[model samples]
Target: MRQVESEEFERLLTDFEREAVHLETRDAYGTAVELPHMAKWAAGEPDDLSWLQGWCETLREHGRAGRSVRRARIVSEPLSDYQRWSHSIAHPMVDAGEDIRWVPRRLVSGVGIPGNDFYLFDDRTAVFLHYAGSGLSVGMTATEDPRAIGLCRTAFEAVWGLATPHRDYRPV
Candidate 1:
């Protein structure tokens, strides 16, 4: 196992060759970069979401390069404020070529989820995202072990199968 730096993980966003699949099991998050934006949302202030453009551009690049990016979010229903806000802002990413799907936690009750959210890169590397109880990110640990890779791939696929595409999700 390797401890992955945030920068290195960001690079993998554009470095992977075939596909990148991410599974998010959190209902709320306190990512430093996103907190202020979410605050604006909660305050009824408008945000241009310009901060998201770089990521959107990256997604577009992946599309042009024939690399695919997909994310499955397993969220609690009667959605948390963060997720409700997330649903409202997902259009740009989806439009930029990411396949984002949402599945209610209820739907995944019978599935075995990984201990943390993770990104599986090309089915070879798995980067597990660790977070604090307050929803702040702690760190990410990555592994190339086949068991870990298989676990992420399997879990993500199981949730993906039960998720609704971004456009179709109504976020109850």
Candidate 2:
């Protein structure tokens, strides 16, 4: 797996021709970018989702370009604070033309989920996210290994099939 910078990862999203799929396996992601938003969410402050405007625009642009974006999040029952926040804030993505789904971890009994979260582009390239134990993102690795790409595609599809749409999934 070749390590890639975050900018390169973003470029893959922009460059993909068909679709981009994301598999999120973690219950919490303690990234610097999310910390403040999470804090506000935890405090019950009304979220001003203007921060998502840029990402929403990106998704919109992709949609306009005939590309699809999808995400499947594997979450545990009795959702973590971060997960709840994530679920609550997903409407912007939906409005921007991205499809998001949530699969309860218990439902994935025999599914072979990868150790790290990943983004698969056009079913060809896979970018795996490495995170510290504290849930902080450390780095990313991108590869076109058929084995890796196939694994991610299979796992993501499995979860996507079983997951509930964001509108129907209520966080605990």
Candidate 3:
């Protein structure tokens, strides 16, 4: 890979922050599959292969750069088969001593309803609506009040703290 200058990297980050989008997607296994598939494509790898290799490449790159990558907290209503499969692929970051978190439906309490499957990046700027066996759609605007994001993060922490590793995971 060509080395990116500091200014170029900063510019890239700025652009990502300014135009970042988020999605509110369906809770489906295909959504999970897409995450890794995109990763592989980004690394010029065969899209058919599991993003397992790309994920490791990312970790190594971050490690070499002394950067830290945080895992996401998935907040969903009732746990579904797709969520379970998603966890299987996403948990490796945590297992490798990188920071990854999750909150599944089975562990949540005092929650009125489940939040939509959404992606929050650039600190909740862009969210994409992911679906199974179809194209992705745009998610609604995440409220400016970071509180919603905070709440979701908090709930994820709560569930993540009590949830088992994928290796030990059983159906939700």
Candidate 4:
């Protein structure tokens, strides 16, 4: 498991030839970049998501190149503040050609999902993002191990099949 820098992780998205799939297992992520938007959403104010334009554009570019970007988020039943905020802001990504889905944690009881969040690229490279106790991203581990990639691909597909699409999911 070689630790990868954040830039390296971002590079994978642009470098992948076929698809990029992500599995988010955390209910909340304490990233400073998102705090302001999350606060605005929590306060019932209109969120200014201009900061995400770059990312949205990246997804759009991938779509133009005939690549796919998809994500499956496993969230608790009673949504956390972060989860609610995330749901509220998911439209931009969807509009940019990324497919996002939400899966209730309770429904994943018997699923053999990995504990950590990860991004699998082209079914070959798996980059597992590590988080601290407070949900801050610590680092990422990149692996090309077939066994690890197989598990991630299988688990993500299972969740994707069971999860609801962003347009249809109503957060609790």
Candidate 5:
């Protein structure tokens, strides 16, 4: 049986703890977030995913502020009207300096829904998971690990460069 080294296991646990904090503290606005693999796993479909609710609330909170939380993504499936309605209500709050960021999604990436899973965060972090179904995870954290953050930042920059910004965006 393959066994993890004691030190390595400890480090992994520590990293998980750090990651939890890192993910929670940051203003999490993403294009294709792994909702299924959220920090919490409830029975069946997560009807009341606190993280998702928090995500929405965080965006809305940022929307109230002047700084908009932007997002870029290549859409795969169409969103429901209710989803559109919720976003539409939250998006404007950012523009109005209410406490939300106008997160935008770019449908330019040439990948299908199941094959394409990527997350980018404000040019600071990027994570690409499930490249070959083995599922990979990479991202930066505001922890003491400078090198880790640097690696994630590099990946984010690469994807950001290839992505297109929101259509309504007008550079300030």
Candidate 6:
């Protein structure tokens, strides 16, 4: 296992081959890029979501390459403010080819999940996300350990099986 800086982590997002599966176990986050967007959402301001175009374009390129990108979010019922805003902005990404799903936390009581959120690339590398209490990211750690890979695979598949496709889910 090795500690990965944010820049390397960003590279991993586009460098993977076959697929990228992400599991989000948090209901809230305070990422610098996202905070302002969420604040605008909270204030009922309009957001054209131009900032997301780059990622969406990336997704499109991945799609063209036959690479799959999927994300599963484990959220609480009634949803947090962040998730509410997230749902609103997901359409463009979904439209661009990422398969985004949501699983209500109550449904996963019996499943064993990793303590941190992560992105598993091509089922080989696992980059775990670490965060402060305020939900800002502290750092990221990456590993190619089989045990970590297996656990993440198991947990993500379990949640994915129970999750609702974004278009079909209505928060709470």
TM-score of each: 0.98, 0.97, 0.46, 0.97, 0.30, 0.98
Question: Which runs of model 1 end up more than 4 angstroms from their true locations?
Answer: none
Number of the predicted model whose lDDT against the real structure is largest: 6
Runs with alpha carbons beyond 4 Å of true place in candidate 5:
1-54, 65-143, 166-172
Point out where model 6 deviates above 4 Å: none
Model 3 lDDT tens row, 119-163: 334454322233335434332333434766555445444555655
Predicted candidate 4 versus true structure: per-residue lDDT over 30-93, tens digit per residue: 8889988888887889966899999999999999999999999999989998998899899999
**lDDT by residue (tens digit), candidate 2, 1-172:** 8999978987997889999999999999998978899999888888788889999999999999989999999999999988998988899999998999999999999899888999999888999999998999899998999999889999999999999999999887
The clash tally of candidate 2 reads 0
Candidate 1 global lDDT: 0.95
In order, candidate lDDTs are 0.95, 0.92, 0.46, 0.93, 0.33, 0.95
User: Candidate 6's residue-wise lDDT over 1-172, tens digit each?
Assistant: 7999878988999989999999999989999999999999999999999999999999999999999999999999899999999999999999999999999999999999999999999889999999999999999999999999999999999999999999999976
Q: After superposition, how far is residue 53 of candidate 2 from its true place, in Å?
A: 0.5
Residue 147 alpha-carbon offset, candidate 5, angstroms: 1.0
56 Cα displacement, candidate 2 (Å): 0.2
What's the true lDDT of residue 76 in model 6?
A: 97
TM-score of 2: 0.97
lDDT tens digits, residue span 72-147, model 5: 3322234333223333334332343322222223432432222223333343333333222223333322223445
lDDT of 4 at 43: 84
Model 3 Cα RMSD, 1 decimal: 9.0
lDDT of 3 at 85: 49
